[model samples]
Target: MRSPQLRDATSPTGCALTATTALARLPALAPCLPEFSDIVPWPRRRGCRADAVVGWGQRPTTARARQWALRHQLPFIALEEGFLRSWGPAAEGYASHSLVVDHSGIYYDASAPSDLESLIEHGRISPEDELRASGLIARLRHSRLSKVNHAPDIPLPASPRPRVLVVDQTRNDASIVGGLADRQRFHQMLDHALTRHPDADILVKVHPEVIAGRRQGHLEHAGRHPRCQLLADDINPWALFDAVQAVHVVTSQLGFEALLAGLPVTCHGLPFYAGWGLTTDHLRCPRRHRRASLPRLFAAAYLHYSRYANPYTGAPSTLEDTLDLLEDQQRHIDAGRGHWRCHGLSRWKQRFVGDFLGPKACVSHHSQGRFEPSAVATSTERQLLWGSQIPAATGVSRMEDGFLRSVGLGIDLVRPLSLVIDRCGIHYDPGRPSELERLIAHGRFSPRELARAARLIQQLRQHKLSKYNPHHEPSRLPELPGNRPRLLVVGQVESDASVRLGAGRIRTNAQLLREVRRTRPDAFIVYRPHPDVMAGVRQGAQVSSDDWDRLVADVDITTLIDRVDEVHTMTSLTGFEALIRERRVVTYGMPFYAGWGLTQDHVPAPDRRGRKISLEQLVVAALIRYPRYVDPCSRQLINVETAVQLLASARQNPPELTLFQRLYRLTRRYLHGPY
Candidate 1:
């Protein structure tokens, strides 16, 4: 008796008790036993109810028994070993079913062996299973069948030239048409075959789902070929088999069907059906060890009787049937309509959601019919608000409605100031009226040299600002009842110094804290590390502390301040938020708002520094100047306002840029004097 393993083997219905012992017991307890050979007769006394009988025997005996069972309408299970032994070692037998058996003596049993064998001989496994298991037969009843159905009835054309059929599914959504590797390869093979055989009619059948309007076809280039005819009309594959002399494929299952038809197949890739002796191989299989004949190969796959349940009905069916039914269900689902939730009301919903409601409205502006405040604003209103002049040679109009519309649509509008600043980090020196005259007198500068003048002015502006704001006033520091004036710096801590070009001496965070403490001994410096910094990519385990004292311990620093009323940052949302609270801001980098003569800028201003602009204008410039806004849902680039709404959710949970802010100040001190 076979001992049952505690783990139940799954069946279509559910788990069933399966064991060698249970099977052995079947012969003894069967109530209606089939006529058995004298060599292995059933025990007559232990009668059990079994609907049918199956057993091992010689080929002649098993065949005779199978005939009798079929006549009596009884199910018969044949032991595979007898067939293999009778066929002899030279005979490969059926390739598909060869590997069905396991070492445990468990073998797959096709419900009707004779029917399954006939289907395999006809090379109709996929379609036959689809008809038997899914409502595909019923669906076909509503549609027209091709004129030809059987292999023999289909007549070959007068020409004996090889015809190649290329099959591929095109509805995969992850890629665009002509983008998938398999699809591209299939087209390449088709082109190669057509170029080789110009007269050959390449019948390209669209996948059934794509034909039925259940999915979109990705093969847009299919129509361009003069020799290729797209089979949009309902035509059976058997009909196609009669027309085509040969087949070429990348990895379609049709290659398998072509083999069963005895037609030569050229595989560009190693599909499951390609390696076995069944098909004429054009491509070598990478997995050389597992190749076998078609029948034995399939027997191992289909005859193995583990039933899969339907997701919708929860009823058991063969694995083949389960897939067919699932595809059918998907087709039906794709044909139906769907509902969508409104996204227009997102801003209203976002406001009441939590503490992360982004930067408060510091200023508001009027547009055509709409009154809204820019969510992200800087204190220097003019630099953020005004539009710059366009040059005549550039053929650009600053006031062109279309140009404004383009800017509003999120197109990068190149401003004279922005171009100069980005290139040389400088702006014009208005205070030195004769500065341009001096350059002209020295023959050192021209109209093109105005850009050089701007850079010098920007450097002077940064120098004067840094000199005056050397240290924060102790009185201006929030009254936290502490002897130390706490300064909080927030932003990206590590620079290219840590990654590409390794500079060993630059300890960015350490240098910044040391400089700030040196400038104001009475102030406590709190270093809040960037969230991205603490993500554990590098900098070792030492960088993981939020505690001020722990963060600034080894650097020349005063006591670390943990919390503060004022926050400083470079391009961090915290900077914008801090400004809404009316806190004095000192910026290290020329993030969009810096150098409008607004917040103290670390970098020199641009050459054509525009008048002080509003926060809205700055937001608009950055949106139009820097990165393009790509819509996630539609995959289209949208305007700045749309980009703003997309990023507005960041306001709800504004992050602190502790590490970056500290590093910027540290770099400044290192470049200026001593850290």
Candidate 2:
């Protein structure tokens, strides 16, 4: 044996020249030496003492040489961080020696910066160094350097089941290193691998930095499974390659290493090694070439490698191990739970102050059993609690109290009654309407004044009728014969009054009267008010005769006409009545009748045949197709059937006037505006 001559070197460039000089002295080392850079040609001699020489760096030449060694099955050593930073955590098991070289020359302290300048000054490492040679000593100390001369020649393990290794960097919390989808798939693939290979041992290698406590847990449930062995301690990954059969991963660079080891790899996701004709891919890679070679694959990786720059150091690491390390670092950061503290805070603030004085609180309390209020009482109190055309009555003290309590306000200047009246549709801007109307002859009184005036007008009309005729007219008039079919109109008269009066309801009335008169010269069209409309009337208050007259005048149908032989409608309950009365009915739209093949419908029902259907069935489908009754205050949907049942029960056992007043008071507090 002879001592190799040591040469002084300056730059990393100088180190290469010095290495060439050293190789010149030891002609036996030529074979082990990596293919020289463009500056140095291949040695003329065939036989050399050096079986192989390994180098590590975050550059193209060092990476190319690493790939060449793997392709040639040459034993090589690599620092874990350099390899991870180049290719990712998956490359940990690929090389003969996987060493962790901390920046401070410590074994596992990744926080320290490398002493590359000191090494350069000492001439031990060159100034033009491709990588920090200071860490190399530490790496070699912890690595399988003694076995490099005579690499172990163990055969691949023989197992009936497939061998799989899961490589990931752990963090403080049990989260997957990759994105959500990647994490989920990784778990699924792990489960699949275990199920497919029941007797197989799945090796899970934690990132060296993660094992050293720089990061946290990333494996989650995968790390705890009986089949999985967490490789937290430092061990030569190549030894596992000799023991295991195959490798499984989720886009890990380990797939590439497994390929070099001549081991089969199953990739659950699109890793850089996937679609390179190297691994058994579980996912398709869009950038994959149809026919891939080692050199072509390297070209693709090298070309795309320029896109990334290390966020921490701002340096670029093109080597496979370097990319792996960088990716693992990012994964560690992402998996940490503290990363989401700011995000959670932002969302919490948004929802906290969104609704300070809205219907949501009232409804939420009512739904949660903290409060109970009758539906009718709620509706009536709502009408009065908020200012409306009608003034609050003296006996409605309880209602006022309830409104105040509901709004969390006392009887101050800002009373609930005042707020309601101020905000109500009719009471808004009282001064403008009253002052302007009184000043101008054409102007009308304020809504409150108008309501009072209307009441007086109705009283006078009733007084005159009582003073004269002394008898009220029959609610329904006698039926009459008509040339055209007679039609009846009905439904939510107040809400859809404009539409019904303008369209089908009025049209049916006018057309029936005209056609009947033109054909038989004598026919009748009946207009029936809804039961709910009639029930809305308050006793002792005179009806608006003018409003009634106006409604009749707007429709061309004759008010005197009574009998309805045929009915036309949109979705009015009058159609249902007409159906019960055996009058022929025609539906212009999907007015529920259009589907029941019984009536002459203008619109055809796509789902219904000529089959007769019960009125209850029609009502159920229309009202209960997953119907949700939303609380006007809360805007949250309540159980539809429960609401309906409550309404029916209330109708069956109507509350007394005193009980009603109590309920009105209680409900007024919770009733604000319709949500």
Candidate 3:
């Protein structure tokens, strides 16, 4: 007998998929239980009585076994994909897959009592649980329920055309067979879609599995039509949903996802999500006849009905844990999946990030146009573009990271802010609305979320946290002659991508400072140049003391901010930090934090930032909810509390540099010349 490090527990019906998970969660099954596969035939051929039976719900095979289990007076545990968002592909139920292993009745079965709705009424959910649920919803909207690819956008025709999408499912799935649908075939759904929406352009999208050729779908053999087009592109499902006016489905998960994405869904089947008054349903189930809001439905399905295991530890986890795991998984897959040549990275920088990033992925330093462009484009998985802007490469996906930098505190040598990892691109570039901005602008913050945001804001304020560490001691400011309101003009790199994309009217630091002087001439103006420009790593327009009344350096920014009544900037995070301190802020550009009605705005982000919300709500959505943090020592996924503590400790006691790091610093300084 094996030591049981990996358990192979089975149910009485023996209709279960293989689950290779950690030993900690192995269920208590009979020691003498036979293998699951062996018991599949015995339930139908010979009657056997047992305590319980476990199987995935609604499949043809499992449905029969479940009936047998009920007939024999045994309890049945129904397994299904957790109705909430998932990190990876949910269709494949392998090890490390998140699931809803429910003991109460399965959600889709109309005849049985529901575990999901009961939890909404009676479950003892905590504040943290609510926070997790809110975070999951935000991620779904921001990343479009995808952990892997964010930029998988397939642009549609530019010609004006109204489009309606009909999402297809695998022919043999349990959802169709067991959900009591009128027609399970994709062709039947297509004909109905064409007839219902005559004026609109109809696009039939097949499941990802069908595209991969792993399984057969109804449209596999159906001849293509001139009016209706079958789409098998690699575009993300969420993107497809966004492009279409409405979505039609028969027991497909896409219908549920489309509803969450705020699309009108017409369902031909009685899936769990349909008949809830949210979607227009052709088939009705009495169980879900009660009307419900999206959030309440999300709470019932995600927080109550499902169980999640930690992606890192394999222990049972929460929604917060799932977010962290998904972020980690996203970073890992992005970094480790494709073979690529990294551009614009120094040898030392490569070594620095590579050690922490592990060796599963390939990283090579090659100058632009040095490698064979054709070979590099075709051979590797994705091109790792290491900069503020993406390269001109046409074909491959771009895995954008901010060149092995951290966002935490103290010297950049030891403690770092968390590494920025984005599948499409980094957050600062306003070329497209970054995920953080999307979350802040569109995400709904509940009362519990607002409370959590309040706590995080308190932490940031008490600790005097800003984007960069305060390397110098707090110095006394020049005393203002009178009590006239003081103004601080924040400066940033003129050539930075954020300025190019977001700094709409006033482009440079000097221009912003001059504008501030013209606007508030009487107010005592203080200008602080960007640290990167001062360090000579980045360039900015010159701003002498003549440009502003006073130019300050070698002093803590917190001290400078304290002496001023107002802070002005063009898309600097400093403006947001000042907002944290409750100071009056005016913006020349639409930074992610701006346009929320919290700051005096000079530009418009009307489409992106129209959802009027509170400052506490913004903090919860951006800091507590959006950003991913990692422990510096353990290199593991961590919560916001742990990240804050690590940064605080780094600020208090700056870590000493090793000899090699010191040498590297010296070499880098000599190579870059003076600031």
Candidate 4:
């Protein structure tokens, strides 16, 4: 019994799929359990009741599952891996992304009608589904995703004229058997490719397990034929798709992937996608009577039948979320230049920094005199300094809190899910250009990118998130005279690096408020202290209540910004947030957002930042492109959208502070500096 070691967190449902408990004999059913609710293990679910028997599709357990279902007079469910599986092979113990639960039959079994086949045949493929399918197909092409998404993209092997790809599968694989294929069929697949494309180069692509040496493939020795070259490297399918003109397969998932890639596919056996008129097939499934379009097939197979789950949080997630998770993992794996050495990292930081930097990171708190001879890493190592900026040095990266940072203040020792590591210069110090600035000036904010930025803006405003997503307590103000423009002065940590570098003549909160008063004496001034200052973890300038009409003890940032007409800031990210909310922002100094034709600049614009930019463009650079985000629970780098989703989730269900967390807050004052 191949009960895979896939248990991490048990399903929140606590029972099996359907009202009748499912006797899930395999751990592979875990991803599917969340959607169907209640999941119970084997013997526990065994009873005379109308329970269902379930097993992974067409593996060694299918016969056992069928017998159990037949003897007990209960139904059976066939589960299989979905289209986008994971970052690594299932045999290698990586978690799955999605699963397909078949009540009638499995997808690979073309002899009978499966839910996917039924959906393809009679399912209503709405215009909306087609539209979404078009987008999904585009995403599939862009992501270059396969059933297994482990390999890195490499340059295509240069072969002769027209390239024909022959996909190889492991011996007696369920799909092959269900497709009515055997070792002879794989040989036939290769032979057909070689004969049909006589003048073309036939690239025989081996299975990932074959490349791992875990299983032998039928075409591993295809190189024996001069015209047929064996693809031994664990090459990414997308990369191979770029070079291959057509694909030949015996029910391998790669054939479906090729069809999705817009490649002409010839299936030697009756795969689920074959007889539906999506691909040319040697054998036909008579049950598949309808001619389905590519989008319709994809819609039925991926969107309708498959269930997606977030590998990190064990929460029910969308296909887009899983794709984001895989993309992030792949990017980080590629981002690894060498080993990472974090200098003077604290225990609190040590726990989470590695979640950003991959597992190759080695953290050494300054107290560890072990490797402290200068603390700078050698050429092959990336040096990381926490919280503060390092002197401009090659390979030494500075880490700081991101703009859409957290639900609570970082000074309070709350875990930050996002951080921006800048190699050029920090975003706040406009004295020199940061990587973010470069992205803003040079990045092609395509329609897709702008749309993402636009979504992020809505998430921020809708969820009311900021650098420190402070509580949304509405503050009452003293009644003011009629029609006076409300000017909001945002305070910043005086000793903070942003104030030290970005602030010019009017540096302090008092100075900013006085300037606002001098500029618009008739305006009703509202001053909101920075959360870090309010928490007493950082220093702030002493200002009497007379400087502003309102102290504004407890107010939501977005709500306050919405009520005000204009915001005055000396490099406060509130200025950026206010800008996101479409409020007129007046900056006393040059923030990264200033000088981009977005804000009212009180100081001369930085010479390097003269380009005019839209609000969407600025967001695409700073939030989407610049900062690296990770889910706190999963400790995996996530896309900004996932980050926003996480922040929104955390806001709705705020976790109660453990005793240690409450204690950690007390010592934050000491650690906020120099740690």
Candidate 5:
């Protein structure tokens, strides 16, 4: 987020823009628009000049861009920030993820046919986009995402009186003038709302810009009405929708959002979404002849009409990418809104855990001896003990390492990009039903979620990404003695929580190896120790030369899993990764994936996890739906797909640790003996 005042047209993503500096001046819009340099004519022109003229909706600079297009006799494109912009208003420096680049007219203006309107009227939407639209809409509602997503999600008035919402817009907003409305329309809209819902109290919603003191709204005086209450705070629109019975608007985008939320909407002004039979529009457009479904309109407006950027990277992106990014942003921000008292995390883990908790969070580390009862000074503060540490009390939550963890070994002090904060229980522990187990049992596998999981699986296979994707490979595994079903015995730190809690009777690598040798005496067994154990930084079970044919050292986990015919694990994540790669997994202990029909289990799964789930379900719950990931490139909260993509990219190798950092890691590992 660079200062908008910077003259260069390049965006924060470091890509050149699609519009001239006149339009790309707002750094926030640069992602949507990708290589414009010369709105400010240089004394001498240099590189390639912009081919087509572009401008944002109705700005003073846009008027100049339009004049330039007219003088040059070229087509002028109108670009407006798309419906799902960012967490907050543009004025607040939150950048835009989506932008509507219209060749005809902008989407907000109903005075003429915009591309969105044309698409709604006569454009064809493919069945795929329609289905995608339904999924996107469902996610939008589920996420409670409105155009600007940074608003505080607070509960609206809980009075028994049915609430009728009145959405107010900035005075003389371009949509107001273009959609055939004026200041008087706000008054009329309010009066109509009062008349139509006499029993309902009016909840007047103010524009974000108005609340910021940067702009004025048409209904600023509406608070004078005894029944009308001004909602001056930047409240989350979807949350507000939940409390309101119906919404009334004069060209405010909240009307469109209300429709998306399945609330009855009355549009007093002819905005682009109005007159499409979706909303009860008092003002209609003859050009909008065809009735529109919510998905159709959303597809036309979001999928077909708008362009998006991989907010983390400057590359062109899809609507789904934006949804994931925004959802993570909200989750991070909302979590940070609370006070956190964290206990039992190693010194190396403190900074990375803070990243998942979000920036605004107030977090204090409480090592065993350092924790004081009164340290939780505020009544509002919450405690999150390390997951798998049986808590003495109930109010605290649990935090653990997520499945798609990081690029380097966690023992090497490589901060993880993903983590799980479970209020229910840690996923690895099947001693009792964890949150992940409950999701496996009760969660429905929608087609959209399953498809996403399927893609993630493909990516994981293509990228060869495992929890800690270190760049090490052992010499080619010794050619199997007879190609007799080869078995891989993956070892873990004996003291690790997963082993202690999840490994039931087979609690140690020594036990796991003995069990495998006894069960399959004929098979050639390859034993690989945990990276930390191999590095001599952690305790490991003793291994004998007679236990296996090959004692592998520093081997890549992915390569090891691929080479094996079957995997033997007592609560190691290697078992889970093996399952994802479609290899046979025999779980001696009760790791999260063992109970499902997908793996051969020596121990019975918790009775609560009775529902038979697919690998796709497991992938969705563990990778897509569960963990929180931060993009290493941007250090911003990101989706699993983006995380995997970043890890897979050849250019995304993590920087070499500074000498001081290396020494620090070495000193800490030796002094503390690994976390």
Candidate 6:
């Protein structure tokens, strides 16, 4: 249990080390670490092998390092501000600003060990801790991200009349991305606010994203009413909330923040905070059918759901730490250096990309193969595409792929809330030996991890969630023949990167189905084509007239999976989806999940996957450990749990689209082509 020394530990598994400034903060543990300095330039860190790495959370540098770590069975410990909000040592899957990282485990992963439940169950709130928690709530509200740093000092109205604030979210954001009513809901809320509080002057606070010109908002052409003023001023949200008579929101977290600030909040849309009795909610959620007090809600959301950090010192933090960091950051902002500043080619690209980033966005592309080599890398503005165009750079493909996603033909930004900038690559690529594969094979599986995974698996199964959701209602599954095993042969785009990479010998969906048929002739075959193929955006393996006689393609995969007893794939994620349903999965080629004992493999398993893992362990590695997530609204890093919840909610609610998205969907044929 003693603090580890660099030389004293040669990683038991010999996983490569990917250290960032996080190691510098832990000088006492430095001598025990290996020489990473020898590896000049960040991209080359991919080749270095160490059991574990220490780095700052969530930047291209650390993200790439994490990608490498995950792919090679290397443990990645990300450091950020602790939940208490000062520079205290913290570790989680990635450094999404809102994530609460416990060295023992992450708060989002319910399976990870936590004390929240015990505290709540036992009513063991220490008077000191309770006081601290309450004080922490006030501090967080005063110094929240939407409030602190770079916000202008806008004077409030001196009128005696009460002011009701209606928080307007960005047109396309995480709240919408995660599954809330779309941009139109904000407009409806505006109309409701006008009707509900005619006596009170209404102020609509525009989201920071809209202010920064990344996307549009509902209030753009509302034509200011005498009682309503569209406040596009980049002022502190907390300040606005403090001055407001009451707060109204569709699904913005500001409503939750306002509640923490001890203000009355009315929620028109269902956010995580709605339906908990704290807010006067229009939406009734079955999940949160119970009532809870402000302190309890605060504990669950802030203490349990978020990890904090001290901006000045790189150490584990608390409210005290945040206070100091906030002061320093505010000072920097006042001095005009607090915002993210970028130079170089990355900045150039950012400008060309139509300013999708927020006001604090800063990017730089420095020469010498690294962006800003000497300057300290911050969590503020992320640096990207450094040396990417150069042939010598290791991450050219990743950079190129990312660029394509951002500006590629036919693919609209609305569809993707978070980007997988880590080594796992894109969501669908099973071809590369992603960090997901590494986690499956070598990640330590705790009982808690397994339990969390089990719950997530259950949720996915119960909800029938799939990657790239088919928008239409699932067709009613045909009755299965008595006593015959149903085998679902999922189809994939033959031209897709996943198939090109993972489908070693059997490259086509038709071939995979044929192989499954050849192996299981007695089993009924249900071939569900890829949704992209169904949409005509891409082509799946062409099932010639000869093969069409035996395969069934009309049933929805979501409903179809329920009737199937087995799933067979070369490398489609459908196999993983089936495994979650407790359906037996037979892999024809090596997928990241293939070697892990979960699925039956046709190809020889890699020697690296000798250790048998449970379903939850696989979920933790693939879902939690592997991907990088971001909040679409706040445009900051978020945890996998948040992403999953958002995905599930969005699936159920399915937000209304903006005019552009609707138009894009309608004219998709003209917009789409091979990139």
Query: 1-675 in candidate 2: lDDT tens per residue?
Result: 111112111212211121123223322122112232212212421233233333332223345545654565554332222222221122322221122221232211112212321222222222222232223222323332222211222344466655677665444211122211244675677777787678788877665566566665456446678778776655445665667777776655555555545578887765444555767777653434454544333323322111222222222222222323322222222222121101111232223211221212221111112222233243423211222212322211111111111111121111111011111122111212211112222223333223333433333222221100111234534434455544453333333322332234333433433443344333344444433233332111223322211122122122222245666555553454344344576554344344555576644544423445543343332222211232223222222222332233333443333564445444543452111
Give per-residue CA lDDT, model 5, range 139-239, as digits (tens).
88898988887778888757989899998888767888999989888899999999998998999988656867889988888889988988888788888
Better of 2 and 4 by lDDT: 4
Better of 1 and 3 by TM-score: 3
Judged by lDDT relative to the true structure, which candidate is superior, 5 or 6?
Answer: 5
What would the TM-score be for candidate 6 when compared with the true structure? 0.45
Ranking by lDDT: 5, 4, 3, 6, 1, 2
Q: Is candidate 1 or candidate 4 better by lDDT?
A: 4
Q: Against the unseen true structure, what C-alpha lDDT does each candidate score? A: 0.35, 0.35, 0.61, 0.75, 0.77, 0.55
Model 4 CA deviation exceeding 4 Å by range = 1-55, 60-75, 89-94, 126-128, 160-163, 198-201, 211-213, 223-228, 309-333, 336-338, 341-344, 359-388, 394-396, 470-484, 656-675
Superposed Cα deviation of residue 43, candidate 4 (Å):
5.4
- Model 4 per-residue lDDT tens digits across residues 1-675: 011112234434333422222324333355555434556555554542435666667666467657767886777777777888887775664667788878898998877778888899898878778777878789879877787766768888576488989988888687887887778888888888888998899888886678788898888878889888778778788888899889999998888888888899999988888987778889977777898888888888888888777665555666766666676667654564356767766688887877776543454444333334354554466667754444455556778888878887675578887888887778888888788888887788878678768877988888877776655544453444448898889987788788889899987888878878888988899888987667656656688777898877477777788888899999988899899999999999888899989998978986778789999999988987778887776565667877877787777776666787667666775566522
* Tens digit per residue, CA lDDT, model 3, 536-601: 444456775666877775556766787789999998888878888889999999777887789998
Q: What are the clash counts of all predictions, listed in order?
A: 53, 43, 5, 4, 6, 42
For candidate 4, give the lDDT: 0.75
Ranking by TM-score: 5, 4, 3, 6, 1, 2
How do the predictions measure up, each by TM-score? 0.25, 0.24, 0.49, 0.84, 0.85, 0.45
TM-score of 1: 0.25
Off by over 4 Å in 3: 1-75, 90-98, 117-139, 146-151, 182-185, 221-223, 314-317, 320-340, 343-363, 366-675
Question: Candidate 5 — worst ten consecutive residues by lDDT sum?
Answer: 1-10
Which of candidates 3 and 5 reaches a greater TM-score?
A: 5
Model 6, 507: alpha-carbon shift in Å? 0.9
Score candidate 5 by lDDT: 0.77
Candidate 3's TM-score reads 0.49
lDDT at residue 200 of model 5 (Cα atoms): 89
